[model samples]
Target chain A: MIGATRHYEIDIDKVDHMSKQLTEEEKSQIYDDIKEFLSEELDVPADQITPQSKIIDDLNGDSMIYLELVEMFKKRFDVNVEVRLIGQYFQRHPIYTVGETAQAVYDIVERGDNLLADEDKASV
Target chain B: MDQGIELVELSALTAPGVEIALIDIERHPHLEDAADQFLEPDERARFVTLRSPHRRREWLAARVCAKLLAARKGLIAGPHEARIAQDRSGRPALVDPAGRAVTGITDCSLSHKGRFACACLGRPPIARVGIDIETVSPRLRSLRDAFVNPSDAMEFHVDTDADLALLWSLKEAYSKAIGAGLHIGLKNITSNRNPATNSLRVRTLAGRVAHARHVVYSNCVVAVCFIAQ
Candidate 1:
């Protein structure tokens, strides 16, 4: 599960603007890691996925599958990915290419990691 | 209130043979303080039940729903006899006791707002059922889009406040009725009023679930969903 966060470091601009609340590099790493993890988990070829792979249409991912992917990311990254965020992204943007997904992943990771880290440091 | 009752009766179409029970948790005494005894032994073993007042309300609501279901059907009921479990996203469900495969699917939904809690129960022979109720609050101004689809947004053109609340209730009810994770994405489903059919069409990318027979009582909006046998 932590494989995604460990795999690649992401760039800031690849993230969705509305979710640009976190660091660019952390987001980029998470995005690359998730795509790698997903490609492996889904048994789809790795090269088939890019920074913009559409989760549903291209990878043939379903809602439940996306959720499982998110859970794995959370397990790996130790971040709280609200279920509502998935809906927000799917509703707001249904882009299914790997590049698109990678971008989305970057946004989520950066925003998510920062929030988790802040909350963690605060509690300490 | 009369319209609300009619809506409830219509939503009752979800379960044909199974008995239905409705209870207001606010009416039950000591409900707000029974968190300890309310937990199932299994849950107690796992140490998941928290002592928060909100959890107490949820437990009380679950217990009350189970008890009412048992009483109405004349079945033996025990503490947590309904056998509740949550989906991956923590949505609640009641296990069917019939063991007959057909009898163990107890359909239910719970909603709480302010000091009140409400639940709806149905079973197979009865398709799927979900119900949601929420108190009207001014705070909803910021949460309207969180509840409705683009189509339903039209019907809400007038009383935006109540409309938003109703849509929110429908979203909860749909989630419960489907008994799936919130991943289904409330946006996937669209709601629209058909003036010709006088029924609310609740649709997803494919087809429709139950109709949104609207019912409101007090300061709450109650939406029920059910498929007829």
Candidate 2:
């Protein structure tokens, strides 16, 4: 279950958000929301999810759930990243923990279709 | 729930020459040792890295299910003989003790939901196979729109949550068999039940006419799909 098959065809002004890097405050909110969502999806307690708490090995997260997380951000924040890019990104920057997942979501929201390495982070 | 597996429900989901399993995933407190004996070296490394006690146990239990199915089919001598690894898309795949892909086993898959786990291992003509088991619950009905379209709901007679769960399992089975796993959107896959043949018609991940079937067992919906290469 490391992949998601569901994709939305909605036309959210995702284009408007592209290239708009979120401020640290915005990113912080994104991170907390992701952690909260993970807690609900995995049925795990919120306090148990540490910065190091893994999405799969620890949280029993199926990749499909990760896809849902991506979709969630898309609807809520009008971000757009094809599932393929998400998969391709994970192949190289393999994210296993909640913090990592949050960062990835932050990247998608800011960069949209173009995913860069974490080291390429420009504005922190 | 009886740990004693009566293959009645699972039997419907099984293809010829394929080994299938549906069993309770009990926590084994001695998993560090169990992982040493039950898993491949890399699998063991991954096992120890698991922080969740729940996941560690589920991980071992799934391998045990796969090993038990393979053992019952005489495919391997023992647990240490074969290793369960992920395929290119991260689906569970079978390999030898040395990490070489096992020949003749064209397809295999694993799924865990709630306290139960399921696995399927298919031989030569099977080409590829996928199997899934969902613990029937009202939650699935509530989330039906996430995966179900009107066509599928109508075809499967989606009255109860269990029916929706079976529908979900059928689509999951096809997607996993096709090697897409959960990446293939559940909405795209549809099932039309054929009472005449006691099977569900579907398209495999390979785009061939999928050989698929499903069965219900005590609050569980188990389904499988096989496509010959």
Candidate 3:
């Protein structure tokens, strides 16, 4: 397990701006990218992944796989993010669906700044 | 289902000097306090570094179970007299109160899932031992392609989710017994189920063969592997 101490501030204004800049096509592409990555990593068929698919329960991903998925997302999205930060976000928000995870990744790309700042709010 | 720690004698599988113990940690809330008494100073220090209470409890439960199994095999007089420590490769090794490796003990493997933890101990002539416990669920089915070989699928006729879980558990036990862990691909370990005998034949990538047997207790499945020299 890797550990780091830093703050990640979710800038609502930046997120709003990025969300506004994001087109429907781009959002759909991002979702497709996530599904494709999961399909390869989990060795599951692409048809199995849906908006409602749960990463752990539906895809059989453990905590270690969750971290690996975070790493893959970082590489795919070209975002500089920490594993602990994503872990903290998931811990606080409890992402249950594939759509929710994709949305979280979008937020991380647009607004994730020192996510560990809110350590007191959630345990990861 | 009975909740306490139950010792199931593998009388048919047991060699000259071997013992197996299965502990249901959920049933032993009292063991949490008792765990501290059994842990060595270094073990207690390591326990404090765990961030999650769930992880801490699981670690304590595994240690307590390992120590109890050690005591039962006469490796130590009591749980407090033996300590389970991991080597550089994260493989567990038993140490005496004086911090010496226990003689005659070959290898021990411990595994836990959900509320269950199982430990298998082997002495001389019994080169390796591995045991794993897993809850049967649909989640395991999703990992079939990643872990199960096509030959294993055909030989075992793994059609259901429970069957996949059983295969995964058997591979995990075999890997642990071989001390390769996941470094050895799950697919590299092939398995064939003997329907008549209700046993599994596991062959590793190195061409070593071992026999495994599983027992279902409650919603969890326990698999044990023994490799004799």
Candidate 4:
């Protein structure tokens, strides 16, 4: 039920991405949040989770859990990017592991409303 | 076979061309009691890989439901002969020992509630099938905004938590039938209720219509939905 509110308008100009990138501290924070979220949701130990741990094979995760993570970031960062576009991006370039998903969340937050822009393709 | 065939008549819960079977996990024997009776070696191997004990129970219950139905329908030599494997998209299928999808079973869906799990199957010409079970409680009432929209239902009158739970199950079933689950966004799968019969005319934004039959069994809302190819 998280990320229930899908309809939101983010003025791309007012996003104020602070030069449109994530700082090192911000990256670490994102990783920490992911660790906590997956640990709590999947009921796995936080220590066992790694950036390279596969969500499905390693952490016993399904797509719905990943969708919850997306909704959590949407509310926490207030970056209401298009979830459908991200879903399509996921289809084209799937993120399998913990670190890849963290990087995707960072991109989703940093890119804000332009997550689907041609130039903003997720590296993973 | 007794478990599945007997429950098919539990309710009039039926779609046009699909068959469904329910498993009351609370009443069924434990996995430790009879896992080998149903689960194949490879199936047991996959089961051992699941870490969470709660998830393992649900997974075993769902597979039992699917396998019982498949065995009763003569789709397999027995329960252990087929495996209900989920693809990367998270859509489950009835597959043979060699890892290929089985014939006469175009789609197979598994859903689990607190103590109940249901499996549904449909053949070719029917593109997909999905089944879901959810308890009707205050929890569903609190998450109104998550599943329902202003444009979703006009005169449907979602005046009770049970009604809202039905809506949520309908959406979940349709999402599974389409192989997207909640990844496609909850709002994308919409429905208009047939207030008289309580059946739903569910549709997606892509204009795909699925027929769903809903029934309330032992405080759980169950839905089975399917679409034509």
Please give the CA lDDT of all the candidate structures. Answer: 0.54, 0.71, 0.67, 0.73
Cα lDDT tens digits for candidate 3, A19-59: 32445666677688778767875667899889888765566
> Model 1's CAPRI class?
incorrect
Q: Count the backbone clashes (under 3 Å) in each candidate.
A: 20, 7, 5, 0
Error of 1 at B68 (Å): 2.0
lDDT by residue for model 3 over B131-185, one digit each (tens)? 7777787765545655678888687657786777778788888877887644366
| Residue B199 in model 3: lDDT | 72
Off by over 4 Å in 3: A1-124, B1-17, B194-198
lDDT of 1 at B153: 62
Candidate 1 on B1-229: residue-level lDDT in tens? Answer: 0111111222432335334334455555565445344445554443333333444555455545554454345443443444455565556666544312224445556555544555555665666677676666554553344445677767665246677667767766766676643556665666777799676756566645666666666778777766545
Candidate 1 positional error at B10, Å: 11
Which window of ten consecutive residues has the lowest lDDT sum in model 1 chain B?
B1-10
Q: What ranges in model 4 sit over 4 Å off?
A: A1-14, A17-19, A38-64, A93-100, A119-124, B1-10, B98-103, B135-147, B153-164, B181-183, B195-197
Q: Give per-residue CA lDDT, model 2, range B1-229, as digits (tens).
A: 1133322227656667567886565443443455566777788887888877777777777787787677667777777788898856677778887777666676778877766677888897788888887777665544455567678757766878777778878888888887764435566677776788866788634466677877776678788888876
TM-scores of all models? 0.57, 0.78, 0.64, 0.78
lDDT of 3 at B63: 75
**Worst ten-residue run, lDDT, model 4 chain B?**
B1-10
**How much is the lDDT of residue B81 in candidate 2?**
81
Arranged by lDDT, best first: 4, 2, 3, 1
Model 2, stretches more than 4 Å misplaced? Answer: A1-17, A41-43, A78-95, A111-124, B1-9, B27-34, B138-146, B157-160, B181-183, B194-196, B204-206
